[model samples]
Target: MQLGTFSFVTKLAGFEYTKFVRYDDEGDLRVIKAENAGPHGFKTTNYSRVRSSSVAELTRSRLHGGELLMVFVGAGTGNVATVPEGKDFFLGPNIGMMRVETDTVSPRFVELFLRSSVGKALATAAMKAVAQPSLSMGTIRQIPVLLPPAEEQQEILRLVEQALTAAAECGADVREQQSSADILRQSILAAAFRGELA
Candidate 1:
């Protein structure tokens, strides 16, 4: 199903708020900017501190679980990824979060589409670079979406989740093997230095 810009979807779904919810820059809340996002997703290694004064700022664009967070209005504009579950986080000025109206659109389906080549092309086209390439809410709202049936969306999400879980497990295994290799290398080096290899 061909759907017009994001605004159309929001309006169709009766999303009452058009404004993004802004969070306060305070407490131990981790502020994730465009820079903190890796190609895969949100990078947590380094984060900025939220100021007490900046707390309570709400953006209708506030990210929650199952939302697709796109890096709009920033240097990293066009970078898109889904926010993983269980992470209470907020986006800075450089990012925009799209909350899919579950009744009308599947967040998982949107996430998959955004990661697709077609979505990438749309993003590239929408992005404007003067000093910094940034995407405005209007630009985002203008991008078209293929709206699949609700059941199809749910099935797609389940498949995607399963695949992601498998991929993560594979990554963990690789890391374990790498760690073992490192340990073995260190042991061999020590043994050789002690003339055990001779």
Candidate 2:
């Protein structure tokens, strides 16, 4: 399979918020900004939205699941997130979309790779050397992706999923221990304050 830009993705574009579009608090569609692209996934809290009717013209920018959302500019440049399936979200400004083109390659694998250290280093090197250090569509298109066989890619994804699940469980255990320590410390402080620490 061709590994060029067009081989993996059909669409590589950025959306811009225009003055003509108005944000609505009660809108059904959510606009995902850079801040929404969190470490785990897209965070929906406090996101801006436009009425579905108002953004009919921008339906092209609407995410249809598994689209890799990349922050092409600003401090968080190179950050990537995948749009969850069935989410009613539109690509907000400063973020670019890579709509996977081929079924041979899994979008989840690509997203995971892009968020990896090696992948991030590749993206970092592709950034413009100007004052702003933004990644243009042309540059993003040129970023090389390591494509293994389909089975291998799936295996890698499975391994990564297991690692993440283990990490999350470890994190939860640490938090629980910290909470217990905090309670013990508080109890000790209370006892000392009440002159019961003899």
TM-score of each: 0.70, 0.89
Local lDDT at 83 for model 1: 64
- lDDT per residue for candidate 1 within 68-186, as digits (tens), equals 66776555676766666776555555666666644767766776776678876876685775887776666776777777788887888898889989999999999999999999999
**lDDT (tens digit, per residue) of candidate 2 on 1-198:** 222453333232433355335788988888878786666655667888878787677656777777877788887888888888887787777777887777778888877887889888887796877877688766777777888988999999999999999999999999999999999999999999999999
Lowest lDDT 10-residue stretch of candidate 2:
7-16
Which regions of candidate 1 are displaced past 4 Å? 1-32, 45-66, 82-91, 129-131
RMSD of 2: 2.6
**Model 2 misplaced regions, further than 4 Å:** 1-16
